[model samples]
Target: MSKVRGTNTLPEMRVRRALHSMDYRFRLHRPDLPGKPDIVLQKHRVCIFVHGCFWHSHPGCVRATTPESNGEFWAKKLAGNVERDRRSALELAEMGWRVCVIWECETRYTDALVLAVNRCMKHSGPISL
Candidate 1:
């Protein structure tokens, strides 16, 4: 599925639009950050990751369907993705940066996406989990 994107995803673009409309300035994909978060508000010490439901293995999400073929391969692949996400998030947190993970499903719901971003803008915490 090379056609599948790993950057500039649809949900990521939407989040960027919302943040821009709110006058929240941020860096796109800061390489210095763990996992190279989608949007990085350096001034606020906050980073946001717009994760795909299928790629990040969003729990309880219908979009995260396991392939009927190559069952074991898909399972291991998704599991690794999730594990990597956890590790990178932990690393960012331990380094004193606030992290916000916005899943594709959440972004699909306007209210949820808005709420999460607004909270990120206003939150003074280290991480939103």
Candidate 2:
């Protein structure tokens, strides 16, 4: 567990790079907000969360499996992660912030990831990015 990383992960970097290439500007992890979203486009009131499949318990994701040993502990820990994520997303929504979660598995495909990001931004509003 010592090697587990919470921020600046490869998946997060991939998303950041895609945003930059698309000429979108953003801030990294604003502590003042709930969950400290991985990327924030303050001007557009958008927050991006780059969630690991296992950590955030991505539904139907193969990588989100748990070990047989200490299964109880793993289940509880993963459940807690999901709960916290849900709360944070809700809070951000209440604050009128648009939240986007880019899963780690999705980052594996660069082209698709870019399109996904673009689509997400489009839904946010009339932004000239």
Candidate 3:
């Protein structure tokens, strides 16, 4: 678990790279937020979260498997992550912020990832990617 990273993850980096290429600048991990969002666009009232399938327990995700050993611990940990994410998203929404979650599985498909990012960015403004 030591190798597990919570920030600057592969999917996050891919999205960051794509956004940067498009000349879209954003803040990384704003601490003031409830969940410390991975990317923040202050001007657009947007925040992005890059979640791991296993960690966040993505619904219907095959990668989100319960550990055979210490299943209870894993379950508790994963559940907490999910609950925190939900609460944070809710809080951000209540504050008029748009939240986008980029899952680990999404990284396997760059085109889809790009489209998702573009769609979010569309609400902010036109960007060249």
Candidate 4:
């Protein structure tokens, strides 16, 4: 679980690659921002969070499975993760930043991920929710 240590995960790297190929220069894990977004494009005022489908409890995702044992513990733990994510996104938006979440599942397809990133960057408001 501590393998990624909350940075430089596979999905995050993939997203970074796509963004770079698009010619969008950006910073990574800006500590000053809420949740310390995985990728920060301050020039565009956009914050991208690369969330794991399981850890962030991606709704309707098969990867977000619950453990048969310690049901209560896993439930509470995952719930907390989701709540924290929601709060961070809200905070970023209130601070006038456009927040986008690229889930782990989404990163599996390089073409689709690139298109989604491009589309989100063109939008006016937060595309995270």
Candidate 5:
């Protein structure tokens, strides 16, 4: 568990590089923000979270499978992660920030991920649900 990373992960780096190449400047994990979003575009008021499929319990994701041993513990831990994510996103939305979650599975397709980020940045106002 100690080896696991919470920030500057591969997926996060990929997204950051892609966005930077596109001339989109962003802040990294601003402490004042709810959940301290991984990528914060102050100009666009958009916050992006590059989440691991397993840790965040991505719905229907193959990597989200729980371990056979210590299933109860893993289940609780993952559930808490999901719940915390939901709460943080909601709080950010309430604060008029656009929240975007880029799942680890989606990072495999760089083109699609870049397109999604572009769309999110272009979007104006608070996200609808």
Candidate 6:
């Protein structure tokens, strides 16, 4: 829909805020990047994508439920999103950039989101739940 936004979304903002609070600096949606990642830490060579569960079709996510109306269209659209995501991530990885995909559901827990950012930054130590 026209109301749908592709950037600065609530989930993306949540991740950005958490990372900023952790003293991490990042760039927002660099067009040069494969996917114009939500957060790009050039120093750390990491790219973060804050994907909506419904939009990106997050596996096993309740929010990913398909719409009853226009079933075929929604399925096709969602599937394309997933495919493009995978291709973009692969391309970024091949280009030597560490890619991190944080689903909308994961953004609900700031602590976990922070941990995921840290992990993507390659900080040492176990990633406990």
Per-residue lDDT for 74 in model 1? 95
lDDT of 2 at 106: 88
- Per-candidate TM-scores read 0.89, 0.92, 0.88, 0.90, 0.90, 0.91
List per-prediction Cα lDDT, in the order shown. 0.85, 0.87, 0.85, 0.88, 0.87, 0.87
lDDT of 4 by residue, 1-129 (tens): 556468998999999988887778999999999999999998999999999998999999999998889999999999999999999999999999999999898889866686668666985543332
- Runs off by more than 4 Å, candidate 3: 122-129
lDDT of 6 at 42: 90
What would the per-residue lDDT of candidate 5 be over residues 1-129, giving only the tens digit for each residue? 999999999999988887887788999999998899999999988999999999998899999899999999999999999999999999999999999998888778866676666666774433221
Residue-level lDDT tens digits of model 2 in 24-112 = 89999899999999899988899999999988899899999987899999999999999999999999999999988888998898766
lDDT of 6 by residue, 16-119 (tens): 88878767899999999888899999988899999999999989989999999999999999999999999999999999999988888888886777677677
Let me know the TM-score candidate 4 reaches against the reference structure.
Answer: 0.90
What is the model-wide C-alpha lDDT for candidate 6? 0.87
Error of 5 at 117 (Å): 1.5
Instruction: State candidate 6's TM-score.
Output: 0.91
The lDDT, on a scale of 0 to 1, for candidate 3 is 0.85
lDDT of 3 by residue, 90-124 (tens): 99999999989878887678677776787776646
- Prediction RMSDs, each to the true structure: 4.0, 3.0, 2.3, 4.1, 4.6, 2.3
Worst 10 residues of 2 by lDDT: 120-129
Candidate 1 per-residue lDDT over residues 57-120, each given as its tens digit: 8888999988999999999999999999999899999999888888888777677777778777
